[model samples]
Target: MSDKNREGKRTARERMLAERAEDEARGRRRKKLIVGGVALAVIAAAVVTGVVVQDQRSKPETPAAAPAGTIGDKNLIVPVGSDNAPSVLTVYEDPRCPACGIFEREFSPTISQLEDAGKIFTNYHIVSFIDRAVPGKGSKYAANALGCAQDAGHFRDYHDVLYRNQPDETNDAFGDKAVLINLGRQVDGLVTPSFEACVNDLEFSGWVSAVQQDFDKSNFKSTPTVLLNGQPIYPKFNNEEITPANLVKWVDAANQGKQVGTPGTHGQSPAPTSTASEPNNPSPKAG
Candidate 1:
């Protein structure tokens, strides 16, 4: 009786061990299947990405044409005033710069007045240095769009609009070509096929790079860097108010002793010969 019971218990234990081994094998097989599935998915994704990249590389490249009115040695400067004006206001700016936006909003009108009066010429050195500092392509793309607008004879308009519609500091909406093209339509005569193509094709990307190269090589420290007759003007004048009146006063001060339009000279000066230049030197209002 004891042998029979012992044999039955031993057989039962053997069967339990065999069943556990089979279960363990099934678990290993399931795990291998899952790992293999994940590996296949990752490989498939890599293949798709490589194909897309290769396709893009295989396409013909269309370099953008140089826009009209590019000045300076590298042809990167966008001039927006009389070449013969008494003073030149050179500004190094990045489209993504918040400070640049503020300067444009506050002093652009005065710049327009001075430009219209033939009192001063405005030179805009657009750059994309922020692309290296920031995480997106907005700075480069927006500057490229401005280059296209320059060719359309609407640089100033488009430039102002870009600043006015500038996205939040964290946003990179300007990176989108469609957004850039849509902004161009607001300026009359800026919505043509060439302008659209220029914005979309990144035609001025090389030009943008050159401009940034010039900027990097310059002595300027930041965007909205303003220079009057090659003399650097501080961004914040008299307690952080860079108003139009302040701009006028600064220009007057810069030209204090020199004759109007004299380059690099200092001191008070008379007005230009043109009657349109009469209001160019408006006295800064008493604060």
Candidate 2:
């Protein structure tokens, strides 16, 4: 064997080893590039997700739509009777409340009479807090139906009918939209397609929520919180029992020198400057 031939074989072996090392280094570089690219893509996705979440958090909520002819702050008041009446009667009530049903049964007739005579007008703030307290949607559904009736120009009639046929507080019968629509049949011209759709679609549900929010913010906490010219008058007025006759007497006394307001087409009225006084009994009760 010659020395030169042995040296050539050794050099060839060294060249093959050098080539293998170069290939391995290139493979490591490629792996690092791929990992770095994936890391960048993940970081970009996280940043985009963060931006979207922040934007959603900062966005303002859309305001609720109010019923037709609603007046007062936040358009929460549902006005019934003559808008021209001299005295204002503010009533805070939940439709599913038993105490409110009793109040309506007792005073509805007199209140209707007074409204017809142009003596006073009523501002109804219908709330749905009962739905939150109870596990039913009766309060919200009933209130929404009332809004539908108001739109149909039969608010007073439908309002009276609901109370007259009100179910037990725990029954949640009014939660059924069909029941509400059937009750609308009692009110003439109140069962039109629009009214039915409103009832079924829960059109005024948002408005009911707004009214409940307003009620929560107000001084009164219970249902059937009645006020006459900003003074608490349910159960009693000026320490006198609130019989139908006594209610007349209280109005008469309030309007002793003032002339009775003329009756006009039913509609919304301006917001009163004075706030309602807190009721003596915060708990709800029938008359």
Candidate 3:
């Protein structure tokens, strides 16, 4: 009776161990499948993201005929009326945006005069949300072209030209390549081959896009959005209270000699002037 009981128990224990081993093997298989699926999903997501970005870079950009102005990055930003200016306004501008243009023409001109007066000095931080328009102004090839122009020493002139001649958002601007080249030519001895090469080169263009993506993550909800003292600038659009004269007078008050657009008065949101095509989607408002 003892031997039979022992044998039965031993057989039962062996079967249990074998079943446990089989179950463990199944578990490993399931784990591997899950890991593999996750990897595939990650890779697919990356590919799709890349494809969408590239597609944006591919849209035909109306090339404004390269201007023959003395074009180049004007490392110097001039805000109107800036004279011994006590306040500083820093701008993050995207040239292709209509709002940005509005910011420039409607808002910035007065400021530029202040700059001219040495009352307030403004610094510009340019970003590219659209692929076309002012070179180095947006995310793709235009940015590279801008960099190239900057390298040649005409960033500001070129920037102004690009904006002055910007086409409608949906319409195309032809001759930007040529305009850029001609403008580059104005620089004493800009490298022609190198300039052309930069325009065609997509690698550096990616750098522009990468920069914009990084910018979007940090600041406001839209392009041409400005920052004052590292905070967002809001221009008050109250018809009576927000006139250009008031802005100038306000800057005068703030600089009581501290760098302020208006002394006690606050501004509404900054305006944008970009009139170019957006990459992927129109610049999403800063969220």
Candidate 4:
């Protein structure tokens, strides 16, 4: 081969080698960039996860403050009447529940009579599930107010007042602290600074939630779930319609051989200065 041709070939071969080296270098740089990006993304994700976990850990859990004179499981019950009564009446209710209002209006007088006579002890489980289904804080607020009333030693009296003044199912009037505080005025010696603060601050909110949780875990589906000695008896019992007469009859039957219970200092319904008006026709389903 000629000298000029050999020189040209050598130069071209050198250029080709240089280009191949450059391409490999570029590939290595790209691989490094890809690996670095992946590492950064993984670190960022881990940091975010850690922050979320830390935030969750830092948040304090709400404390449950049950009312005075509470009894039964988890201190979730507000007892009325006499604990020594032969028959125990378990009542699960919600303040915002229209059916519960009806139950209270219709049966409260009879129940009070029975309590005064020391025939049955009533255990009230106040829940706030209505706030979940309906659009309002009335259930929670009213329940908290009820707790405040209980703390003031006027649960039964204030309970009757609430039902009498109960707003419509959709109305959230009870959500207003002012409304609750004003209602407290109806009960003799209930509207104190502490009672107002308790209602406004939602003092017993955790306790209401606990009661709601218990209701959710139970087999009961709706409010005003009245059980006589652990037996369902609100709407019916033994295939017969439930009435005040039936209730007394059932209690008498249950206490046929047993001695009548004397009224206890706790859980007794005192005579209210005012009377509760009649409840509107409520839905059959008390939810």
| lDDT of the candidates, in the order given | 0.69, 0.75, 0.48, 0.75
Q: Which candidate is the best by TM-score?
A: 2
Q: How do the residues 197-226 of candidate 2 rate in per-residue lDDT, one tens digit apiece?
A: 999998877778777766655556566778
What TM-score would each prediction reach against the true structure?
Answer: 0.66, 0.72, 0.48, 0.71
* Residue-level lDDT for 142 in candidate 4: 92
Q: How many clashing residue pairs, candidate 3?
A: 77
List the lowest-lDDT window of 10 residues for candidate 4.
50-59
What's the C-alpha lDDT at position 230 in model 1?
59
Give a tens-digit lDDT track for model 4, residues 1-287. 99999999999999999999999999999999999999999876543322111111112223367787776556667878766677878788888877788888888898888887888877788877776655789988998888888888888889999999999877889989899899888888888889988988899988887777666656666667878777778688888888888988998898788877677544434322222111112223322
Ranking of predictions according to TM-score? 2, 4, 1, 3
Model 4 spans > 4 angstroms off: 1-63, 265-287
Candidate 1 Cα RMSD (Å): 14.5
Give the poorly placed runs of model 1, Cα more than 4 Å off. 1-65, 236-241, 253-287
lDDT of 3: 0.48
Model 1 TM-score relative to the real fold: 0.66
Candidate 3 wrongly placed segments (more than 4 Å): 1-85, 131-139, 174-176, 183-197, 200-207, 237-243, 258-287
**Native-to-model Cα distance after best TM-score fit, residue 37 in candidate 4, in Å:** 58
